[model samples]
Target: MRAFIFPGQGSQKVGMGTDLAAASTHARELFEEVDDALGQRLFQLMREGPADELMLTENAQPAIMALSMAVLRVLEKEGGVKLADVAGCVAGHSLGEYSALCSAEAIPLAETARLLKLRGQAMQRAVPVGEGAMAALLGADVAKAEDLAEAAEADGEICTVANDNDPGQVVISGHKAAIERAVAMVKDDKDRWGIKRGVPLPVSAPFHCPLMRPAAEEMEKALTETVIVAPSAPLYANVTAEAVSDPALIRSLLVDQVTGRVRWRESVLAMHADGADHFVEIGGKVVGPMVGRIVADAEVMSVQGMDDIEALIKSI
Candidate 1:
């Protein structure tokens, strides 16, 4: 009846998990463990940011996971809530999937932190700066976005829809030229298709398209070398938008997700169909609202700190 979800990359902020670490010993332990695993004080960067360093893909990945896991630990240890008992299923957007897996016990918290750090670094290094970009097409569905992308890919450049986020929000990523072309096309034809907005995202590289195949290959090798276990709760994979329990399948899906469209909209629908009435977003508030838009009748909550966690515990 309840589904716990985790947020991805863009949800991170400078001082995200500080309050949680201050309020709960369990949360503090989670942060300490992540620091030990990564051999660096990621928590320090998260608490006191130089802004630029924390924003780097490599640091952002594990930092976000550390915050989410800290919150999860507080909820379970202090709030007296068991993950297996309260949640029917779990899901997350892109990098959030790693957080969800950690929450489900498919991977240890330390390993999740390390793997996410590697994943972020690989993804960041996959494309050069200014050469690749991503944009959001608001009020446009996947079909229209695809048409626009196809129309804009004629200049020896690659452009493709990357994230099918929700009904009216789709994100495209590829070469900067192709993305610019696609944005122009969308803006030119905005009134014809009821598209009211087209906005470019602030990202260092294009992600989740065929352009990220190198990152996928890198992840494949990294994943094979890492240990993955059957999750305590089913994980709704980003590629399939379906619950996957088998470890091998999860590994394959993680590799595939790099070059595959993140079916976030479909994943929410599938979870709704599977009888999830409540959706709790960990780490940030972005996905909770998106889930609300996808499933209008479902109850949604986002937890960011000790007060929010306490409020959630009381509400649940």
Candidate 2:
């Protein structure tokens, strides 16, 4: 069995899909469609970036999703691979979930792009700049990270584990002070917590925490108006870490995902438990390594450009 997983934020680049768009007409058309939907030449921005504007949450969110979908379309149209037939279940990291839903036809491509644009804008505006922050808890598991997060909270400041990515990797998000406190606690008590170091993340705002309630509310309004259908492939939700086929549940979980932990490790384990032996990381190569760490015995592959698509096809 095979599982298809998509990547989230932090995987974007200045010229993400330029090669693919140049190589495949399908890929180019998809990019054109997205640009038309958003009423902006996003592809141009993606291909030639000043870095700052493309790095904006609003831009990165939709841009990454568009590139991922472009890669998937290339695989389907040029490589003769069908995601709905090959992937038993699908999962994604944070924003990657939107890509998965779009690839599976659960959500319209244009709607997904627009929703992510709103989501990115909302998340960016949720907390004032310098007021919130995020950090990566290296050499720490979820339980240990949670304990460190609780110990790091200062004066009721919000600090919590955001992404349980792999065995020794976890991310935390919250108030800037609390994040600093968490890193300090881990630095001072590394032996007790088994934390190597808490490295601060270069992010616009603290995401996947209570501080993002405003973003969640904004998503609630946007998702309510958008049409969603059941995905052809079951999606292992980031909030629940379980496969869900119900469209209503997927929508609710997406709303919750704005302020919920990305249970990636558990979701990968669940897919493995269901007899998935091959894991395909679509959109970006970042999540592919984490999946390999989660299920050591499973075959892992990442599909990004034309070479990656050919390799993935050959591997299967």
Candidate 3:
């Protein structure tokens, strides 16, 4: 069986979705719809330069979702590969959860765009710039990373694991001082902590930690008012690392996900255990490699543009 996955924030770049928009009318229409929903020329920002603006959390979240949806639209319309027919389940990393739901038809495309825009803004607002930070702990498992975070925490300064990306990589997020202390601990005692290195992330906010409670509250309010339907395929949610289909449960999980650990490693393993041997990543190439790293023999492919879409159609 196959699982369709979506990429998250960091996968975006300056020229994303441009070729798909040019080659497929479905892609073009999807981009146009997203632009109209957010009332901004997001596609132009994605295609043109000015990296700083495109990198903003408000822009990157929806822009990444739009690119993923553009790829899915092309695959459905031009390639005749419906997600419901081909994918046994769906999953996404962080912001990609919205993209996954859009592909599964639980959320409308335009609404997904708008929600992501709001989600990004709320998350950015939850923490002030230069006060929060995240760091990547290389060569460390969740246990080691947690221990490192505990060592770094003190006097109400919060430090906690944000993303358990893989066996070798874990990300932590919290106050800038706590995160800096964690990095320093990893550097000062690499052998003691069993960590090779710690690299601070270039993110605007400390995401997926207790510090994001305010953002979670914001998401809860928005999602409560939004209309959601059951998805065609079950989603392995980031916070739960388990398959969920009920719309209300999905809604609650999404709100919690803002301030919870992204259990990506466990989610991939759970998908593999559930008979999804092949994983297809739509629109971005980042998650495919992570899947390979998680499951040593899992077949993985990433679809980015017309050529990749056509190739995937043939392969499927």
* Clash count (model 2, backbone only): 0
* Candidate 2 lDDT over residue span 121-238, tens digit each: 9998999999999999999999999999998887889999999999989999999999998999888988999999999999999999999999999999999998999999999999
Models sorted by lDDT, best on top: 3, 2, 1
Pairs of residues clashing in candidate 1:
none
| Model 1: lDDT to the true structure | 0.90
lDDT at 33, model 1: 96
Q: What is the lDDT of residue 305 in candidate 2?
A: 89
Structural similarity to truth (TM-score) of each candidate: 0.97, 0.98, 0.99
RMSD of each: 1.1, 0.9, 0.7
* Order of the predicted models by TM-score, top scorer first: 3, 2, 1
Model 1 C-alpha lDDT per residue in residues 102-122, reported as the tens digit of each score: 999999988899899899889
Model 2: pairs clashing at backbone N, Cα or C within 3 Å: none
Instruction: Superpose all Cα atoms of candidate 1 onto the true structure and report the RMSD in Å to 1 decimal.
Output: 1.1
Q: How close is candidate 3 to the true structure, as a TM-score?
A: 0.99
Candidate 2, which segments miss by more than 4 Å at Cα? none
Model 2 poorest 10 in a row by lDDT: 274-283
Worst 10 residues of 1 by lDDT: 189-198
